[model samples]
Structure formats: C-alpha cells, structure tokens
Target: MAPNFSDLVEEARLSLQALVDYGDQLFNPTVRLGVTGLSRAGKTVFITALIHGLLRGGRFPVFEAFATGRIARARLAPQPDDAVPRFAYESHVRTLVEERQWPHSTVDISELRLVIDYQRPNGADRTLTLDIVDYPGEWLLDLPLLAKSYQEWSAESLKLSRQGPRLPLAAAWHAHLATLDPRGRADEQETLTAAGLFTDYLRACRDERFAMSLLPPGRFLMPGGLAGSPALTFAPLDVPADGSAPDGSLWAMMARRYEAYKDVVVRPFFRDHFARLDRQIVLVDALAAFNAGPEALHDLQAALAGILDCFRVGRRTFFASLLRPRIDRILFAATKADHLHHASHDRLEAILKRMVDRAVTQAAFAGAEVDVVALAAVRATREVRMRRGHEQLPSIVGTPLAGEVANGEAFDGSTEVATFPGDLPTQPDGLFSVPADSGSFKGLSHFKGLSHGSADQADYRFLRFRPPQLDNDGGDTPYLPHIRLDRALQFLIGDRLT
Candidate 1:
C-alpha cells in the first residue's frame, strides 16, 4: 500500500526532530534511556536505585566506569523537555531510605537528566547527558494498534476474551456484548454501559490472580486523564472483521473513538518519547506470570513480542541518525529477584530468556543488542539456609508485608521470617509446555506452600517483602542492594561511557 498524506507528514516531523536531536548530540553527547514495565513491575524502584547508586557511589563492581575510579562525578541536571514532569528522585529516595517503603509506581511519562563527568580510557575528560524516560509498559502494548483497524482489533480481542482464564473473567462484558447490535443506531447509554463493563473486565484480568498481559486499549487500565472521555469510552463490538461501519451506526461511533484514541494518546507518545530513545529497559514480573501458570506465561510472551515490535530498533549510522534514530540497545530485565533464593535466580533469568528468545533474535538481526537479566533494583530480602526435616533448604529471609499469609500464618509486617522459595524448572522449556490443570490457578490461592526440595515443582509462589532496613553508619549514604543491576547497566549504556 502507498503511504497516505498523514503518513508522509508524520515521517517529515520525525525527520525534523531526529535532525535537531542529531545536531545537539554532535556537541553534547546524550543517551535517551527509556525505562518501563507493566503495573507493579518496579519501574520507579529501578530508576530510584539506579540514580542513587550512581550519585551516592553505591557498590557496583561490574560497572567499570564507576568501579575503576574513572567517573569523577554524576549529578542531576535540568531535563531538556520543559513540558514533561521531572522524576521525583528526592521524594522517592526519602520514601525508600527514610520511610523504608516502596515508592508509588509510574503512572504517566516522566523525565530525568543525569550528567556524568568521567575520564575516557585514553585519559581524556568528557561529559555524557543521560536522559531517562519512564512510562508505562501498557502504553508500549498500544503502539501496534496503529497498524490495526477497529474491526480487526475487535475480532482479535473477542477471540482472546473467550479463551482460558480470561473466559471466566470476561463473562460480564461478554454478557453485555451479546445484547449489542453493531448495525443498529448508536445508543449513548448503551455505549456507556458497554464501555464500563469492558473496562471492568480489563481491570479484572489485571488482577494478580489472572496476570493477563495482552490486554490492550492500554488506557482502560491506566486511563490517567482520559477517563470518561469519548476516546476511552469505546468497547469492541461483535462485528465482522472485514466489514466497514455504516454511517451514524453503533459501529461507526466506536470506530471513530478508537481512531481518536490512537491520534490523541498513542501517536504523540511514539513520535515524541518512544522514537527518541537510544536505549531501553523493559522490566517483567515473570514470577507473577509463573504463579499464574502457562496461559499467563504465554500471554506475557506475546505481550513482550508486541512491545519489541513497537521499537524502531537497529544500529544507527550518522546519516540514519539525522533522519531517524533507532534504539540500538535493549534490555529485558525480570524484576523482583529478591523474592527468590539465590539458587533459583539463574533459573528465573532462563525463563525470561526463553520468553524473549524470538524477539531477541529479531532485534539482534536488525542490529540491536538485546540481553536479559534477573534483577531486583532494590533488594528486599537476604539469603539463608533453614533446616526443614533432615535436610537444609535454601531460603530467603525477609519481612512479608502486612496481611501476607504463608502456611496459615499471616505476617504482621514487622516480623521477619525465613521461607523456602520454590525452585524453578531446571529447563525453561517445560514451563512453556501445556500445563495440566493442577497448577493453573496457583496465583488465586494465598500460598502454594514451601517446597520441600521438589524438583518437579511448577507453581513458584512468592511473598511480597518490605524494603530492607538500610544501615547508615556515621552518616554515610546507605546503599540500595540489588541483584545483577550492574549487568543490566553494562548492556544498556556501557559502550557510551567507554
């Protein structure tokens, strides 16, 4: 198909922006790093810990520029984008360090600028401006909608709503959907009711029990300011995938709003924020998916693929950078490594690696460097060996959040306990296989019980732990402990620092 006038205009704008960005980079080098993840995937914590580590000189043995005494200073600078909100670094640090609590998750897009003064390997001094863009992963999933028509999206969404765990959760929406007539005249109250039910269904699917990752129309889950607006008030109709909407029909109203959503929400994000990224880190809650079973895992896999497809990923040449910049490096880090014992950490990484294997291959083939790591940006637990029966089991010791229950005992938030976090499958392939009915609803239950050295355990239940108490002796800055965060940093912006 030939490009439309709008497409041409969009391309021109992108080129103009890229040209300006390229010109700026020639004098003052910058790396626009994007950090995002699904709801409760620890994006805020990751960014907070990353900035704190760099500024306060936290322990990072593998981050060569920081560890080798080459980095003279790293400090916050004014972000270039005046319209965007600054990331609340000071407030979040206070929450984590002083209050000993996790900060609120990223609700909308925010930017933070870090300027690093360092000595190059050749002993020359240089500065690098690092602009970190933080947004929701749900927004990333919506990018693919640009290529899809309302009919196609409706058909796909309806099909997905009828399958597996979603089938039960979507019952109310489907019930209302059955009564709607796409060919009839559009009814205001009916449309409103349908939209409400659909939004409720999306919210239900997002429940930690279901852990459904592929739910799009991303704003429904995190509408921000778009709530109750016509743009977010459209629900998928049971219409023919190849059919066009009749003028002034129910289908026409929905189709129009869908287009509006794309124009108003998704497009600006892609053009202004996503397209400008030089590197990105997508955090995943693979453990949540694992507890939810194979269906959730598969859903998460599909979601990851969709997220990667949105990136204009490839190596950037000088001329290419002038017209269109590409994200040359991508990192997919599985968050919440502190929830598991050290022995299962590699296994967790393996599961994530398997999930993104196909996406990684495609990104690499397109000249993007992609890597995966299991990381806890703010480590909340410590490892220990506990005696259970005649043998010792690898256990993680941490304070379970208030009301968190394990083996019929509910924690009171202050009491610390040692529990054996179950082992992951030795090979991640088994996890991708069709699961039997036994472990499918593991996430719905309170706890799966501590595994007594069961190699065959498929349901790995994890308790949410409170942030560890940071020890500040003699007024020294307390370090936020992490797992493999340095490895993640190495793959993302290591070459630029060098």
Candidate 2:
C-alpha cells in the first residue's frame, strides 16, 4: 500500500527530528539504546545491572572495551528528555544488593543516561553518551495496528481468541461478544463491560501456566494512566471484516475509539521514542515458556516475529542519519540463565536462536546486526554438584523466593537449597514440535511422562530465585554477578565504544 498523508507527514516530522538529532550528535556523540521485553522478562533488572556494572566496575571479561582498560570512567548523566521519568537505578540497586530482593517490573516508559569516558586503541580520549530508553515490549506489538483497520483488527483478534489456550480464558468476553450487535445503537455501559472482560481475558492468558505472549492492543494489559479513558475502553466486537459501520452504530463507536487509541497512544510513542532508537536489546524469559510448554513457545515466537516487523532496522549511514535513523544493532537475550546449570546455557541459547531464526534472518537481511545470547543480568544462583544415589548431578544453589515451591517443598526466603535444574534438549528442534494428541493448550500437563528427544518434560523445572547476597565491606560498591552479560554488552555497543 502507498503511504497515506498521515504516514507521509509522520515520516517528514521524523526526518526533521533526525536532522536535528544528527546536528546535535556532531558535537556530542550519543547512542539511543532501547531496552524492552514482555511482562516479567526481567527488563528492569537488566537495565539496572548493566548500568551498575559499568559505573561500579563489575567484572565483564567479554566486554572488551571495559575489560581492556579502554573505558577510563563511567558515570550517570542527566537524561536528555525532560518529560520522561528517569529510571530509578539507585533504588533498584539497593533493592538487589542491600535487601537481596528483585526490583519491581517496568510499568511505564523511562529513560537513563550513562556517560562513559574511554580511550581509543590509538590513545585518544573520547566521551560517549548512552541514553537507555526502557519501555514495555507490549507497546511494540501495537505498532502493527498502524496498518490494520478497526474492522480487520477486530476480526483477527476475535478469531485468535477463539483458538488454543485463549479459548477458555476468553470465555467471559466471548459470551458477552455473542450478544452484542454491531448494527445496534451505541451503548456506553455495554461497551465498558466488553472492554473489562476483554482485558481480564488478556490478563489470564499471561498466567504462569499458559504464558501466552501474542496478546495485543498492548495498552489493555498495561493501561498505566490511560485507565478508564475512552481510548482504552473499547473492545473487539463481532463485526464484518469487510463491511462499513452505519453512522452512530456500536461498530462505528468502536471503530472511532480504536482509531483514537492508535492516534493518542501508539502513534505518539512510535513518533517520540521508538523511531529515535539507534540500538535495541529485547530480553526474553524463554525458561518460562519452556515450563509452560510448546504452545507458549509458539506464541512467543509469533510475538517476536511481530516485534521484529515493527523495528525500523537497516544499515545507518551519514545521509540516513540526517534523514531517518535506523536501529542498526539488535540483541535478543534469553534472560534468567542463572535458572539453569552452565551445561544447559548453550542449549538454551540454541533454543532461542531457533525460535528467532526467521525474524533474525529478516532483520539481518535488512542490514541490522542481530545476535542471541543466554544471560542472567544479575546471577541469582551458583553452580553446584549434588550426589544423587552415587551419581553426581549438576545443580544450582540459591535462595528461592518466599512461597516458591519445588518437589513438594516450599522455601522460605532465608533458606538456601540446591536444586537439579533440568537439562535442555541438545537438539532445539524437538522443543518446537507439537504432538498430535496433546490438544491445543498442551500446558505443563501434556509434557508429563513424555520425552521430547533427549530431554524429558521434567527437564525444565525453573523456580524463581531471590537476588544473590552482596557482601558489603566498608560501604564499597559490591560487584554484581552475571552470566554472559558481557557477551551481551559486546554485541550491543562494543563497536560504538571503540
């Protein structure tokens, strides 16, 4: 389709902004790095740990610029955007280091700036400004809505909700949807009820057991300050995909609100924040999907594909920078590597690589540097070996969060235990295949007593662990332990530092 007037106008405005930004960059080199992931993907922890490691000089052997003494100093700087909230790095660090508790998840968009003074290989000193833009990945899923009309989106959403695990979760919403007539007069209360039920359905899909990831209209799940606003109080109705709504009908009302949501919520975010990113890192809690089963993994794969489609990815040149900025480097990190033993980390990375293969291929073809790594931003567990009937079993030792239960034992927050974290399938392909009779949901139950290649269903027992205890010696900043975080750093911004 040809670009609409609004689309052309948006491109023009983006070009103007890029020109201004490029002019500023001539005097001060900066990289706008966007950090995002779906709910509970450890985005908050990842950002906090990355900044803390740089500022406090945590060990990062793989990050060559930092490890080789090329980085002279790193410090927090005032973020450029005054309107966005500054990420609470101090409080988050305190929560992890002092209290030994994981910080809260990201609920809104925030930004932080890190200024690193480094020496080039030739001994020339240079300063690089890093602007980390943190936001919910759910917002990225909404970008596709820009090209979808209200009728088309409604039809697709309704059809998707009727399938797989979503079928049962969306029962209430579906029941309500059945009675609503698209041609009927617009009624506010009815619309409110439909919206509420729809939101509840989305919430249920995100449950630990299901771990479904393809839920869209992202604002519905994380409304933030937009709660109760008309822009957010609309739901997908049973309407004809190719038909036009009559004036003042319920369908028309819904179509108007849907358009308003795109205009007021999604478009502004794209125009103001997303379009300006020079680099991006998408965090993924693939372990959660492993525990949830194959359906969840499939949904996650689809969600990832949608996310890649939204990125303005391409090779950035001098002329391109002044006209339209493109995200040239993207790192997809499978988070929570500490949940698994070291032996399985490579297998986990392989699984994620397989999941993102198609999307990464497309992004790479478009000139973006794409790579996948399995990492724990903040290592919560340490590797250990446990004797199980004379056989040595590779295990991990960590304090499970209060109320976390495993093998019929509930752990208190203070008690440490060693658990045999299960092995991942060496061949990642087995994880993607679905058994014919496993049914649509095929949650944890379906995997029971079944072996998918070398790994059985029981090989993915991932429990939530509390942050590691930091030794505070005379108030000196303690080093945070991480698995493969340096590798992630190298892929994300190593070239820029050099």
Candidate 3:
C-alpha cells in the first residue's frame, strides 16, 4: 500500500514547515511553545502571567536561568507569523495588574514572541526567541477525529451521550437524532435544527455546574464566527453499527460535512500550529474534576488520554525537525493553586497526576520528558492563620467574586474574607470519586445537591477570587506574584535560555 497524493502533499508541507523552522532557528534560537487547556483552565491567564513574569522579571525562585541571574533581560518582539493575531498582552495584563481582575478566556489562536538575552555559563551572551502559541483546549479535544470516520465518531459520541452524567443533558439531542431518518434526503432547516440542538447539548455538558471536559467538535461551543456555516452545521446521524452511508442521502450529507469539518478545521490546525511546537504545557483545573465527582473525573481522564495521544511525543533534536517537529517536553500544570492553602499544593499535584496518569505514562513511554506542577500564574489569595476556638487553621484570604456565597453571606467583590478552602487527601486514591454505596453515576453522590455555599463545602471545591492588588511600581518593574510558575518555566524552557 502507498500513500495517496493528498497524503504526499500533507507530508511535503510538514517537511517544508519543519525545514523553515530549522533554518530560521540556526540564526535565531527560537522555541515554539504551545499553551492550551480545556475551557476555564486559565490558558489566557497563564500566557499573561508568563509574559509578565519574563518581561517584568517576576519573582520566580525556581526558574534556574532567572534565579541564577544568567538572564540579562526579556522583551516583547513582533511574532514571526503576521497572519496570526497577536496575544493582547498589554490589555490583559492591565486588567490583571491594575484593575485586579481576571481577563477573558481565549476564544481562538493567538501568538506572542518574547526575546530573552541571557549569559551562558561560560559568560558568553546569547539570545533566544520564544514563540508562544495560545489556543483553546477545546480544539485540542478534536484531534482524535483525525483517525476516526464519521460513523465511528457518531457511535462513540452517541454511546458517551447515553452515559451517566451525560445522558440527562443529551436527552434533547438524542430525541432529535431519533426523529431524523438517516436514509431520507437531507433537509436544510432540519439539519440546522439538529446541529443547534447538538451544540446546545455540548454547551450544557460544559457548563460550570457540570464541568464536563470531553466535548468534541470544539467549534460547536465556541464557533468563533463559524456558526451556521456548512462545516459547523453537521450533527451525528443515527446509523447501524456496520453500514455505509448511501450516496445522496441524509447520512451521506452529514458524512460529507463531518469529513469537511476535519479537512477544513481540524487538519489545518494541526498542520499550521500544533505540529510546530518544541515544548507544550497543558493546564488543568483538576479541582473542577474533583468537585464534579467520579464520572466527570473519569471523563476528564479519558479526554486527556485522547488529547495526549495526538502529540508527537519524543525528544526534539536536529534530526527530529529535519523530518518533522517533535515536542521534547510536555508539562501538565494544575492551575489555580491560590484557591487552596499551600499545605495541600503537593497533594493537588499528586491528585492531578493520578487524574492524568494514563496520558503522562503514554507520553513518557515515547521518551518525552513529562512533568506535573501545581501552579497559579497569579496568586490571588494570601495565606493566613485563622483560629477556630483555639485551633489555628491555614486559610486563604481574598476578595471573593461578587455574589460568591459563604454561610448564606454574599461577597461584594471588595470585602476581603478569610475562608478555609478544604484540603485533599495525602493519598491521591480517594480523591476523584466517592464510594459506590454513597450514590450512583460513578459516585456523583459526592456532590449531591451541591450549590452555592453547599457546593463550596465539598473538600475539593474552591471559590473564585479576584486578582491580587499590585504595589505602586509601574510597568518597567512589573513583578507579579505566582505559585510554581517558575518551576514550570524551568521545565519547559530553562535549557533553551541556557
């Protein structure tokens, strides 16, 4: 068997891109670092904090290059690709540093370039360019489609929809699917209605209440202006387990559109941005999965496994680029450490490791240097000791997001409060799920009837806090506070700077 012409063209493009990258890096040491995570995983905040840390020389003790004073300076540079939107660093940082508020999450792909001047151990001065590509982790969830046919995807999706937590949310979509005849001719309005219902189902699954993580066809949730287009209008059709779609039929129409989605949306993303990475970091809101209970935790684990499978996991070397790009290092960072007390940070990391164990193992088996960290790009809360009847407890103090309730009291977004964000188990085994006897749906009983303050009562649940206030020091000396972002930096790009 031989690769078809289309496959040949794709390979040529990949090789050419790699060659261009290699040639460019010979003169300018550049690392294409990719940052992405599922929605609300803090991709935007992570990028903002990372750039602010580098440019402002933020206080990061663990990042070797910065800590050892080997780095002269880091400055923003024009990104190499003009076609891609520049990450709005200035605006986002302002809201975070000045206004003391979080910025909006990422909706599409954006890039930033930071040029760092450093002194090598031998005292020779060198410069390295870091190109950071930030995109929605939702899109990364679609990579599995690269190897799946529409039928396979449909079957998998339908089967998943019928599962414990998803079954209820997928009710309408399943009903709509049932009404449509796969063998009949495709109708425009009917197709639109089905797609709309399917997208709605995905939205429900991704709601903060649910915190589910495995929704695919990423564009369905955040269309990015692709709404109503044919490529985004297809829904999975009901089909027999082993049957082919007939030409000019409803199933065929959906099949064409599904393939079109892969060709038009998924393939180009991999070819243009994904495959070019030298290092990658996947930020995870592991606590959310914990709060969502066992079913969501297992779903997240499955999602992570699928997403990690798409990586060309291996060490990046000169030879790797000559053939194709390889991501040498991959870091899975559990974001939002500030929400909990420092005492449990390691436990959080351990719990996240268990959450992503299979994915990390797969990447490690391929010789990729994989690491995990509990990080907060911005530490929104300060730790304090609160006494409850003579017993001192470690707690975090910050201004909660407006309307955040505690003990039936609502925060005004300006009043500071100290609350004990509960702790994780020293052993990671008992964290993601409750006992089966407690309730059904894979231990969702752990979060039974959780809402507002009651939900926050869950040991793993944490409240959202506003960004911390910064001192009078202006832009030139911006030093944002963070938790272990330096360690993350040390793992991802410390060697490149050296």
Model 2 Cα lDDT, one tens digit per residue, 1-498: 578999999999999999988888889999999999998999999999999999988899999999999999999998679999999999998899889998998889999999999999999999999999999999999999999999999999998898777899999999999999989999999999999999999999999898999888999988988999999999998887889999999999999999999999999999999999999999998988877766788889889989999998999888888788799999999999998889888988998898899989999999899999999999999988877667677888889899987655677899988777756767777666664225553223322321111332233457789999877655467899999999998988899887
Tens digits of per-residue lDDT for model 3 on 185-290? Answer: 8788888989999999999998876788999999888887777889999898778757898888888889899989989899899999998999999999877876
Q: Residue by residue across 59-124, what tens digits does model 1's lDDT show?
A: 888888988988999999987799899999999999998887889988899999999999999999
Q: In candidate 2, which residue pairs get closer than 3 Å at backbone N, Cα or C atoms, i.e. clash?
A: none
In Å, residue 339's CA in model 3 sits off its true spot by 0.8
Candidate 3 ranges with C-alpha deviation above 4 Å = 1-4, 432-460, 474-478
- Residue ranges of candidate 2 with Cα displaced over 4 Å: 435-460, 473-475
Per-model clash counts, in order, read 0, 0, 0
The best candidate by lDDT is 2
TM-score of each: 0.95, 0.95, 0.94
User: What TM-score does structure 1 among the candidates reach?
Assistant: 0.95
Instruction: Report lDDT per candidate.
Output: 0.87, 0.88, 0.84
Off by over 4 Å in 1: 435-460
Q: State model 3's lDDT.
A: 0.84
Collision pairs in model 3: none
